[model samples]
Target: MFPITADWMSFVIVALATLFLIGELLVSTKGIFSILGLGFITIYFASFLDPGMFFVMIIIYFFGLILMIIDGKILNDGTLAVIGLVCMFVSVGFTAPNMVAGLYAVIGVFIGGISSFAFLKVFKKRQMWTKITLFDQLTEEAGYSSINQSYKELVGKRGITTTDMRPIGTVMIGDEEYSAITQGKWVAKDTEVEVMDVDGTKILVKDSEKLQKKSAD
Candidate 1:
């Protein structure tokens, strides 16, 4: 024990640890926040529990934190996050010296986790979280966007079906081939087709012969 007489100190220590740890994972803090968080958590656990229990509790807490990070960065769902928070709560609450300290520690975990978001406003976020959360969007200005400008230019142009469009197949437009759909029509291979629309990467085409026949009718 670290000779801490105050029960509220548990809350303070745990809260600061969680805040910094979560902030470090969510944003780019250059490891400063991680160090501070680890330091506080170590002190908090060491001050109340035996050496063996201390290590166990620390492992549980970190396991929970890892789960939350994984959920936020990859799953983008609350299921794993909820389980992770529960694990953290168990570790801190079980290691406290008394019921009051346990409750305080639990509340601290929740508050600290929630407060970690404040750091996002103060620092540049990690690229992984930003992408998963859609905080950043891919656009033409990004220099390597997936948006293909060539497909957009193909609208209203004439082409020939290189493969049978059992509504979907390839079309040859001026020696360049593109994947195209025939608006639910089954046009045969080698049929003349005209580019009707372009939605993102999807190219919609219609049979040029049918279009001419309809026009003549």
Candidate 2:
């Protein structure tokens, strides 16, 4: 058995290790929390444990962390994360020197997991966090963008009138020509105009001078 002065020493080590490990997983700390947590966890594993079983338990524990990362970051489904948490708690708990120590370890894990939530406000997010939340932002991308998305893209676009107009005329936007009209202002053929509005099939044009002055204001 590894040397330990008191039962509380295991609790402290487990708690600290669990805290830092969970913190590292939850947010980006540039690996500082991971290093510190790993150190404490390694120390805890080495103390009061059989050498032969040490590597095995550690593997089980780390495997749990990997599953969590996969679930939280990759899958975004809770299935693997739940299993991972169970694996981690069980591994740490079962490895303790006694039932009391085991209970402390499990409590430490819970406390660590709960407390790690606070880090969200202070730290930059892991890429996986995006998967877990605000998934509805994609609703804008799926079909809401619309075929007339180009209509909005046309806003402020520059075009030239193809034919003379008292007000209504054909305008060239890029290589493709579009039917357009000015705001009740007469314009001549080949004059440059900016898209003022597009409503279904109707396109409105503005003179460059008017558009420039309006934009400046």
Candidate 2: deviation at residue 50, Å?
2.6
Scored by lDDT, model 2 comes in at 0.79
Model 1, 1-217: lDDT tens digits are 3555788988998999999999998889789999999999999998888899999999999999999988977897889999999999999999888999999999999999999999878899788665567654587776655646888889899998889999899999998999999779899999999998888899999999989999999
**Backbone Cα, N, C clashes tallied per candidate:** 0, 0
Q: What is the TM-score of each candidate against the true structure?
A: 0.83, 0.57
Give the RMSD in angstroms, all C-alphas superposed, for model 2: 11.3
Each prediction's whole-model lDDT (CA): 0.90, 0.79
- Candidate 1: regions farther than 4 A off: 1-7, 27-31, 124-135, 140-146
Q: Model 2 over residues 33-106: C-alpha lDDT tens digits?
A: 99988988888788856787888888888888789878866788899999988988888888888888888787
- Highest TM-score scorer: 1
